[model samples]
Target: MIQTLPLALPGALVDTHRIDLSALYSTGWGVEAHDVAVAPNGEVYALYGVHRYTHGVADDEADPATANLGYRIITRYAADGEVLASAVCCPSDGDGDDSAVVNGGEMTLCVLPDGTLAISARPDCTTLVAPDLGQVLAAYDSNDRRPFEKFTPGDAFASSISVTPSGRLLCVTTEYGVWKYGNTLANVVGVADGPLTPASKPVIEAIASLDPAPTRYGEDDRRDHVRYQGDPVGFDHRPRPALTERLAGEDRLAGWRDSRLGRPVPLADDLFVLPVYGRTFRGGSRGRPFVFALVDDQGAMTGRLGGMDAWDDSPFTGFCFNVASDPHRGRAFHLNRYGLYAWDSSGTLRARLGTDTKTFKPLSRFTLATCSPAGELLLVHTTQHLVLRVPTPDDLADLAPAVEQALRTYARQRTALKSRWSPVNWHWTHTTTVHHL
Candidate 1:
């Protein structure tokens, strides 16, 4: 049987800028990935890590934090592919220790409104660096021996981070906990006092489906130790130490899941164009389940909006959602290993740019990135680490309320997307929470 796959007309996107992140990846004495970690904040795109510099110290002298090897760096670039600034992210631990600092563990990072950088790899370890990547601003650990909170190291692995419209820091861990920070540990106030549920309080009525819907990924992944307890998705997954102490009902295992979001990028003020926050257990299958969703001003899950075809199979190998920033109101782009798919607000494929046939482009990584209102916009940073902004595409404004409303409607009205799965066969219900903020 022959299938006609669609070809992506270049009109869907233009070659923007490519920057060489080699110098940034070089540890001078350690190692780094061939790929660069990029965060979009409107006009400039910041890539995590910086050049390997051996200027001040001898080859034998190593930074105390980086396993006593290389320097941790972060750099920001202007739209024209010019170097905005570069600074050490994981600096040497003071006291003349011969190792890299324990903050901002590795490749994971987020850019704050004030242009500050938050990077973390290990659980509960966060390092805040100045925008220029110049100096360390603040650092935090959940299980710090000095401050000793009741929290575990598991509570600090922030896989995702975003700032709400209100100058508050929002972070989510893979297993458990969602945290918001301002001055002190503000987890008890405002949005911090949340798993911000929907205000409308939609009525939820559980009913059996004419056709049984597919079960969630795993028993342990979604269910409690007994494998049948409570609604992991419906209820709040935040830490309840008392619940853990009791070791009794549904909250027995606490909260744990696979992928936290599709890709951690902001879609709008109170919205994000991302994938599902849950994942399959080790013994089950792996599916790339993505979704569009809304959040309250304080940043909490409001509802599940929709997109993508998970009917029969998954079309993505490697992918990224265009999480927007300031300066440019970039549209939402779904970049699979094959190419890019742009969607209209009405839950339909609008345009595509790239190859119809997979494996056509020999690119390891492709970010639906935007910066520089420059014509020569496409920037390519090669293995050689040359920072150059090549050229760009017109920033499309797509992610709107209408788009989410359409998807939300679709997820509700239709049992399956593109008739790939039967909705009537699935047992589903709406879950609600009290509005915190």
Candidate 2:
């Protein structure tokens, strides 16, 4: 059952419904949705993909067509849970070729400050397609059938995309480096040869030069200096042994490891980059993945900075599928298995919110999160229901007393459990003896 909890004001609450999507579509069809965003007018849009899944049947069951194909779906919804628009972003089987897999549509969409929508798409296996402002918006409104500009020379996977305040669009993928689109998408699309610029070079050398090299010395090496305690050469100093040689081997190993790890690189004026460990299923492990730093335009990297770890080593950490700037706090917020972690404008971690474990509790397990233009929080929870107009700072503060009372109740329960099960208590021992009989 779905539950609704009221939050304190300046907050508006809305009820959510879990539509049984499986029944809405035909069998053998699969759907997965991601990259949800809310517009200034509170309209929500999401990118989804449809595929084929095989289900087992009994001997008596009727035979059915088993071939599976894939396509993409784009859906838009009003604030009041009304379906405003729906379109097939990519028609996978349009060519009627069974051997070829058709992957279409945009993986990432960004709404510019001027109310224009930008989509990053890979129309085929070997090209990157991004339509300009005029083209993108026209496609969104279904005014144009073709809106993508293809970069022919270089192939890229459209994994992620973002638009800067100045109107530059950055398209990125895990396998390929980043590409920049100028003020208009036309400039990049017109050049069919390849990326307008070459892939960014790794800045390993600059980071290595920032530190000084250590001097080498032997364990028995010693030095003596004349000391003038009262007068010139009045006091003589004994030779002191140098400690550098003793730690030379360890220091050299450490330096080598540090060098191999590489240093963080700056993507934009505020954004920085680092390499994070990624997941591996086989016995062998893959190299570390890249982590991008998200920062605000006015923020300085010297202080405020928040980072995204591609594959975090910490057991508590999980994959971050989406990240966005919170308009209310001016911080970058990301969704992870451990909940939402907030980072300042310069890409530094500010705070981590929500429960430690995944649960159906309110304000936890956010699959998709976005801050609307009006500064409201919209979350598509793990339950697959859209939650709109959640509480903000003032609303949380207003409910502080009630929230504290609930926490106190939880604390008391924990204390009672400890008292009942503690090894120091004799009752537990007595109970155990009775059970043995």
Candidate 3:
């Protein structure tokens, strides 16, 4: 089966701007950009997770007092890509240990209508931070306990947040459904309900069905040292399948899984687009996932794109589809390795722009991204420590060449990244102290 790219419709998205945040990542031991958002005014905000490892002691065994020490970093950048302000907030000291003193690692960000940054840093609460990074303006706690607090998976937890046109905050969960809260962060106004599909269940069971072949992958499996307290155990066979079988199962699931939303993109005050975030299964699994769904103000699905399908399977990051809407043009954009796809408000394909360049061996997959009113697409590549800006053009002819040029520009920017920096000084200057409420 030959993979075919999405048909180009009428409009195009061109790459024009780029920002490299590798400097900040180099400053910490295990710093990562968890999320990124672009404000209407062209300002960029990023959620950074700074990992601190106490080798001998686990996260729970570590001191709770220092749990919030250097964990969550939020940086604001100007339209020109200069670091404007950066702050440190929220605790990041939990790893599903029931006895863990602090459980506050997960976080996501979005800018509110009033020009304030809204952050769902903890599972139970969301905060409104002043643009100047001076203070936490207000906070809304759902008064609910997250599964992570109890060290177990449950119905759903906040995975990402966005602002609706009506000045309400939209919270997308890891599963279950999406929530709508007032801009004041006061109360839950509504919810769009849907349970997550057990998309990986079939693949998981196939892998589990394999016969136990000791030393197939490795001899001394690490389960004994990690799970059994060094007790000599039998052959570790659970979920241990042949490499070919595992790959085949994984590929099949990727192509045909039910739709899952990554983050909702508001195209207007009354319209939003939800990207179906997942990868394509290889081995001729012809199923094609829906690209995105258009929703009304009431969170009702109006239309969706299920026509496009890629020819080849390429590995993507945490979220396969990163979506953002250019409300000014009434268009929604979906980004992946295959291309950048655009759809009109009515869910019609408007354009398909490529991001391929020979300068980079493989194009970096951005984990988080957002669009500005001025038609700029801001992308955050966590592993690459890159914050990129690209211009969204309306014509494919213009976009095709611009894509190549912009990618080349990004290549140059990525190449200039230094290997290391002073963690202490970077934290002191770039991270503001926020009280853990």
Candidate 4:
């Protein structure tokens, strides 16, 4: 683990501390960390990589190959803050195999309670597994039944994966719908085919099911009738002499019409479908949406909280980019681009703090953000960082008695040692020595 010396504090200064994690890893240039997961034992795993695209060369042609090539990398840090392992996913440059170039983006990492690390890469739904330490595990894609068959023309990126309380894994993709698999990473493989449908197929069906069916080819019937529904013009049909003006005006009018009508319509029921976090058990409910449920290992719902809603008056929309549970306050704290917000375990919005007050400084330049399993907020914004501890009223109450005793002892010690060192005497006798003989 990386450590730094304590800073001299001003009067009544709160002790701000943060661990500089980059000091422990060799993160390459042009790479940015996307997400981080901390294990129960305090080990931190980060998902990060470079974004690029690779191209393919044509047959029988001497032309240079041109395709977008991207790289994905994953690294694991030990509990003590040492880089234990690292892995990258990239296209092979060998001459034998020729295929379309691959690309990856938007990575996420999660550590199972049993100590397995799950790293999910997006735009291509693949999960790399690192089950134990000291082993250089070769990265593998989630097993594809139709490995030879092309499902989508481009890459299928995996977005996020979360481990349920019962240990099952739930993963979502940019193109493929959400899926749940058995607790282990092996079970999650190929399970995507059994019950889940690819994202494209369902969308095509939904479009076909629209009431006013989309036309493949026909005359421009919808455009001819221009009903003057709003207001009547004061002047018309006066300037009909210039051909160039008419043609230019026609082009501008046509462009505006196309912009208004040519947009693709969204599928129905799309907005109501909430993104599932994971399938977990608490008491009674089974296979419930983790979005609005206080789920536990038994698939039962507990606590007074449910899923969070959009912040109606605020910009963040209430969905937290990162969240940490504070059992001491019975709440979960979140950090958005704006400020901090808190919700109860039941997913109820408890308080909107630090927005207007600015009691907590904004995260201006943090490279990585993590919440301690114990509920402290750690931000690695700079080479020198700051850690903010937000204690609830209950935390203060727990420390009340001890705080009083510690203050009394500090006052007694300070008074006893006040006159022991004099500034003038130290300057005059620079080589003064203590004599005990």
Candidate 5:
């Protein structure tokens, strides 16, 4: 039965639909939904990673041999929760070359204006899957680009990505900052910041482990870090092993694992917001607060939206995992240890809906959220293996007619660009990728 619950806000109800993911997380595997995105046509696409694990292993039984599985899979579902199609776009050889079969994190996904899907996995793997959800159409990774070739794997990773209404691709990386690429994933149009200051220790290890020296990629820097040419707009934008200390002897970690970057929320014009959070060792504090970096399709940082700060000593932690925006309402939604937060484009907090009590309990299980074309929210509850469809509350009323018209205008601009793109043949090589129709 599809379960429905009253949201903290009046006149709003949430529908919970459980997704049967048992097969993906059976005995020796740990699976997580990297991200969930809803297409304009009401189809849902979820990107998940099935990692390998061995528990209760007799200390010497050479872990039971397991079949090689693709590190990640993108599943499509109808609005009513019926499975539509699924395919493994990333292959793992268990050699950790192309994709990580285990211990991979920080992936993001978004549906392009042309109905295709774009997904990014850690260590620099970004692929565009066909609309039918059957194959990978094009791919970009550390192996294919120049600036990407010079840095360590983390430097090239696409922590977050969003396609502009004009069909440009905006991406955020660990070290190289943000980038703007052509929709075809063929060329880079811009860049921002100079790679993260002084690569971290882990990145150093990755550099030393590379064999035969990395090859160079030939591409001009082009329009690197063009200052935000668009008008000002509002938006908003962690991980740590502190789990061991908190859980004590529980033998398990509680709470959701946040990806490196939350899913990007598209806003007016060519702008989008990317949430940034991570652990900070300074002053012995646990983690950093969330910051919403507002950038346009040209890879320029326009403005930043602030989030909760730890110093406030508030009951809830200031960290957030993901953010979704309702461009129609000019509002953005952020999820954190506290609950779901709603903010306007000007960065004003309008509401904070707590899910820790009442009909909507256990906010900790929801790892991420994506807004649908119809203005509904698609949230993922990991612990329950469910997806919750949340309608906009009455309090989040529609924008003035003028503002609504502007949004419609922006969307129309996107639709006109769709003709520039046509589906490509599934020619990428992924020996282990399975097409699960």
Candidate 6:
């Protein structure tokens, strides 16, 4: 049921497709990418699908928990059509054996200003692989290094993540409105500019807290690690997000048990752009309009950016992926099933790309898009196992933050041990950490 809706355009957008995925696409395999990002040198990278387990064992739940493995395959394509890097993801069976898995889906990803990829992977409850429940936020840096850190949010299902210019992380999760995390992934109540207060004081106490500490993980948590039969693993793939069960008579709160937010972007000194998605049937659903909101460093609502209904078309159901913001251009870009949309920092609509049916044929539940500085829009239609390109708006800023080249600085740490003088015969050991030079 693909419907073509008439869309207004500048006559500059020319859509084309590429089918040679170099084995990234095949029959019976599903693909998903929140956005396919283009690098400064024209390299394109994305978090794509890989078979759950090649060998060992299979459970009814394994079929659905593909994304839980983290960025199983960080696929990189050269501007000239070649596979650049084949980075590994997380694990599947007890044996490091993954020829393939059936019925896996797509994933959401964003690149840091320094070229690190941050992914939010929610385990599928239907395919109960492990009983222990939690969500994994994995980071992969530019050099194709292993996941440096896996931040587990005990109660929140992270939907999308973005990094600020100063190196802090920002994201939108299921239960909470929006959150900011430092490089260490610690939840912060404020930014460098000022202290942030909760929009609702009462709601602050009401919401379940972010996991004080990440779930314990071993060094081999990467997806490509070896496994075997009877290896220790969780059988429950079901999600166990903290639910807001009952609210005391606040109609403004409505029935929102968990607010499903889109990508959070830190735009200026204190202003940040937050894309608020409609949470129906647990988010990533269809025909729901996106409400754009603005907040200051204090996490207070400064104003409403308005809904993404500038065209006044149907409700936007497909979630926005790799949402790009151009502070220099004073605008941002969002791609969903409805089409590619350009809006100002104030959430004002500048243009509409197309509709779900008119854009391209979708094979999976999600679609991904990113822009090129050379007046090209590089997109990956995961469902169709294809790469696409279109002309960019003449005035659109190359605010492809993820794609820009950044001179990176890696932090080094020094560890030391301290011993407390024994009072009688008992000695206390303490570990001290020194950061930076």
Q: Local distance difference test, per candidate?
A: 0.33, 0.33, 0.45, 0.31, 0.44, 0.35
lDDT computed for candidate 3: 0.45
| Candidate 3: residue pairs that collide | 3-311, 14-393, 16-391, 17-389, 87-432
TM-score of 5: 0.57
What would the per-residue lDDT of candidate 1 be over residues 94-171, giving only the tens digit for each residue?
Answer: 342332334433245556545666665544355565555555655544333212244233223233354444544444
Candidate 5 C-alpha error for residue 395, in Å: 3.6
What TM-score does each of the candidates earn? 0.47, 0.47, 0.59, 0.42, 0.57, 0.48
TM-score of 3: 0.59
- Per-residue lDDT of candidate 5, residues 1-437 (tens digit): 12111111000100111112234456555555567777878778777654454464343333234333335666676666556655653444334445322123466777866687767654345566677766556554543233434433222434445544444445543322222221112111222222211121011011000011112222322112222233111010111112112223422232212213344566644566655443333364334333565655444556655455544322224333567777666677766555566667666666665555442334545644577766666666554344566566535533222223432443343243233322112001112223532
> Which scores greater on TM-score, model 2 or model 3?
3
Of the two candidates 5 and 6, the one with more favorable lDDT, higher being better, is 5
lDDT of model number 4: 0.31
Per-residue lDDT, model 5, residue 287, is 40
lDDT of 3 by residue, 1-437 (tens): 00001111011100111112233434334555666777877777776655544345454554443232235666776666656666655444433332111234346677766687767644334466777666776554333333223323222223346655455444442211122121111111122222212121000001111112332122321112111122322244332332222333334554323323345666776676655433344543234434455655453556775446644422142234567777767777666665666677777776655446443323446532666667766665545456667776775336555555666676665544322222232221222233232
lDDT of 1 at 424: 21
RMSD of 4: 20.7
Off-target runs (Cα >4 Å) in candidate 5 are 1-28, 55-70, 89-91, 94-105, 144-159, 164-168, 174-263, 281-287, 293-319, 397-437
lDDT measured at residue 399 in model 1 versus the true structure, 0 to 100 = 25
Q: Mark the 10 consecutive residues where model 1 has the least summed lDDT.
A: 1-10
Model 4, span 1-437: residue lDDT tens: 12111111111111111112222324211234456666768666554443322224333333222322223444455565444554444432324123111223444666644565655554334333444433323232332222233432332223344433333343333212112211111111100111121222110111000001122211211111111122210122111221122123423323111110000100111111111222222452222222322333221224323333333222222223344444434555445444445565445665553333433333333322444444444333232221222223343333333323433443353343234422121111112211110
Candidate number achieving the greatest lDDT relative to the actual structure: 3
Global fold similarity of model 6 (TM-score): 0.48
Which ranges in model 2 have alpha carbons more than 4 Å from their true place? 1-29, 55-67, 96-106, 122-159, 164-318, 327-329, 346-348, 357-364, 383-391, 394-437
Number of backbone-clashing residue pairs for each candidate, in the order shown:
46, 8, 5, 31, 4, 31
